[model samples]
Target: MPAVRTTFRSQNHRGRSCRDFPALTVTFNVLQLMTIAFVWLLALVPLTLMALGATMLRAVRPAAAPPGAG
Candidate 1:
């Protein structure tokens, strides 16, 4: 209840509203989302590449024959 009452007032105090500045809000939202996505990409890409490299090496290496086999 209190939060709802202050929401519009806060926007008015800052002179920014979605209706008043649609493009600005959309751009800000996009940039925020992109920042989060970029962080995840940075963290996952290296781990993914390392795992892929390990899998490739595992596939490339052949298993040795059993000791008792001729």
Candidate 2:
């Protein structure tokens, strides 16, 4: 009788632990996704500004050849 009770207790504990695993995994996945999105946005800002600056410079300044031109 004691052995049967112990087995039932262990089974209940195992079932609860298993149920909690997916919730922990989903939380971790959400945090990782948020971190990746933040890093991507941080990187994109500088690149976008650089592209805009290049476009503006091209519009404002025309290229000049050397003094001894053909």
Candidate 3:
């Protein structure tokens, strides 16, 4: 019957669509991971600069010895 043939075609299309799902999912996950990594790197910049500045200050001004340690 024509209906049976149409159902078969529909099932074949659905099978192809299902097969394509993993690739699409992987692409989406990769994009999401990249976005998250970009955000984390962006957030880290200020902290990284602050830490670098603190290190520079330490090198510029050595800590004085404590009176009790003398």
Candidate 4:
């Protein structure tokens, strides 16, 4: 009976440890998502700047034709 009680106790402890596993998994997934979003935002900065620069250049340039056209 004592050995059986010991086995049950050990099993109970193992189960208790696993109770927090789901919450940890969720937290890990959220962190990974945040990291991915940060990387995407970093990548977007250069493209956004390039687009803005192009728009500004077009706005500032004169609409005159090329010099070679008679």
Candidate 5:
């Protein structure tokens, strides 16, 4: 076994962990999450429009009854 050395070290701030987020980090995270959500909804727009069109088409006509069954 040889001496093992660690390359990554944490930042120091009054014994606080480096993972503590600054204002910019939090803002970026929120923006990134919102962007992803926005893209997801944008991707669904086509499908939603198709469904609306189908509903409109359905509203345009009713099913015809069988002969002698009216």
Candidate 6:
């Protein structure tokens, strides 16, 4: 029989955990939210532009080909 050894140990901070680190935690959360929003908006803008361009091209381009092919 072999004894099992744990590779990870949890820190037993009695009361001064991440909750105690208010400014850094709040800043990190705010930055995370902003980054997510920025990435989402970045994706949305291009898709919206592509959709608008496709619609405009479909509306304005002629359907018939030039009169030369048989």
Q: Clashes in each model (backbone N, CA, C under 3 Å)?
A: 0, 0, 0, 0, 0, 0
Per-model TM-score, in order, reads 0.62, 0.53, 0.56, 0.58, 0.58, 0.59
* lDDT per residue (tens digit) for residues 1-70 in model 6: 9997654444565436677889999999999999999999999999999999999888766554455642
RMSD of 1: 6.0
Residue pairs whose backbone atoms clash in candidate 3: none
Residue-level error in angstroms, candidate 5, position 31: 1.6
The candidate that achieves the highest TM-score relative to the unseen native structure: 1
49 Cα displacement, candidate 4 (Å): 0.9
Candidate 4 lDDT over residue span 1-70, tens digit each: 4554445456547557545699898898999999999999999999999999999888766555456663
Residues 1-70, model 5: lDDT tens digits: 9997654655544456536768767898999999999999999999999999999878755555456664
Q: Candidate 6: which stretches are off by over 4 Å? A: 1-15, 62-70
The TM-score that candidate 3 achieves is: 0.56
Candidate 3, backbone clash total: 0
Worst 10 residues of 5 by lDDT: 9-18
| Model 6 worst lDDT run, 10 consecutive residues | 6-15
Model 1 misses residue 65 by how many Å? 9.1
Residue-level lDDT of model 3, residues 1-70, one tens digit each, is 4554445456547556545689888888999999999999999999999999999888766456555664
Cα lDDT tens digits, model 1, 12-57, are 4676457888888899999999999999999999999999999988
Which candidate, 3 or 6, would have the higher TM-score against the true structure?
6
lDDT of each: 0.81, 0.79, 0.80, 0.80, 0.78, 0.82
Candidate 4 — which pairs collide? none
What would the per-residue lDDT of candidate 2 be over residues 17-54, giving only the tens digit for each residue? 54568988889899999999999999999999999999
